[model samples]
Target: MPSRAPDDIERAHLRDPNDRRFTIARRLPPEPLRAWLRRFWIPVWDVPDGESAAQRVLQYPVCLSITTPGYSRFVGPNPGLSTTVLEGRSWGFGTMFAPAAGAVLSPGTLRDLAGTHCDLEQIPALAGLTEPVRVLMAEDPSAEETHAACCALVEERLERLGVPGEEDLLINAIVEEVEGDSSLLTVGQLGERFGLGERSLQRLVSRRLGLTPAWLIRRRRLHEAAGALRGTEELAELAARLGYADQSHFTHDFRTSTGSTPGEFARRWRDES
Candidate 1:
């Protein structure tokens, strides 16, 4: 019989990351993040509740996103990094797509990319996805190498769409915002800073980044709150800093977006910590 697959590796659309929730001690190393998934998409089963699934994908600065077959044939705003779990039945391999400059739009009112398995040239309205894309994914080359290559090719195409001479600035600004306050900064605020009107900024952000500025900021804040939950920061205090008017409000939003309340998240995190 073929040697048992390594524990670190698993077959497609099978394994679940939901049974157990895990927290990274630090930022997930980019090397590993960029490397192929040794197993199927791990679900973040503990986001807003008892368990969500080990699968979580997000786009940060310019709407960095992680996708699976689950997002296929779907549209509409995803809440909380838009945490979505996808199975190989629709798509395979957990892939991460980062925006280098512009925005990425979900194929709203369009068919899922998995349906056609189309090559780059055949992909419809891809220009509407985003600009300056950097996609990374790994799969058994012998079995699904073609899809893997397709992802890479798509990344190259998107990368070419980065905003002219503004990729670096946009990335830095978003990162800074995420790293800074958790205040209730509105879309208009984000747009004004970019020297664009609210609607214009929204269009730019949606077109190039694939998400609204609000989603990006909210997700980052939630991630930070999750990180801070186990630290010295007071629970009530942290929630406020993240722009939650009160603990209940923060708890509700966190659970809605992440699938777990702040107290529960911290408790689980403490167990893990």
Candidate 2:
């Protein structure tokens, strides 16, 4: 089984650490499903009347989530930060999908869903599981029970669809390699390492993930940089570690993706903390 520790780089993206409005728990699924499922997450929140807390996250590659008294949806890769306001009392359970798992879960190509959220009922393969999922989550079961129920639902879906193909595994492997190595700064470099021609690599990723190899590499660097901003003031060193040419280049990309300079973001987080 994969390690259960949360991605430390992702944890740094939280909008507020001082706000005591909610709690989140994450667990690994059973061994059979790990190839397709990243982790199961449950977030429970209660806000005082007339007061609301906003939770912000730099979403993982992809996700399928069900909110209580709410809706069930599959969210594609979001290029920017995603934020939701919490009011009253509410909870949600979500399945974080592996990068290429969408190929098996969606009837259409993943490109169609990029930067968008689709209702689970709209997808043929996942539609049947929607209502049963709602009933199981509505009962407010314990974490262990919730994990078991979700695992069963996913297992059934995989069984019906059959196992993922080699193309799916190839796409996933590419994503894993980029995420694991910061030195891979460009799609050309990534292709060389994987022994694929640049255009072939691009075509493969675009077909399966609806995203380019460059986008995946840049997003991973930005996510790690966002996490480091809170702890380090040496922007140049941070940029070097993230494989950027220099601080200026890193600043440009960070502002483009996050809408704020690293220094400004760090200052705001510090003030709030």
Give all candidates' CA lDDT scores. Answer: 0.43, 0.74
Q: Residues 10-56, candidate 2, lDDT per residue (tens digit)?
A: 44355665677787667776666666877777777889999999776
Best by lDDT: 2
Task: Show model 2 residue runs off by greater than 4 Å.
Answer: 1-9, 141-143, 268-273
Per-residue lDDT for 126-219 in model 1, tens only?
4322222223222322233333344444444444444434554464455455446565457766666667687876665555445566766776
Clashing pairs in 2: none
Q: Hey, what RMSD does candidate 1 come out at?
A: 9.8
What TM-score would you give candidate 1 relative to the actual structure?
0.51
Top candidate on TM-score is 2
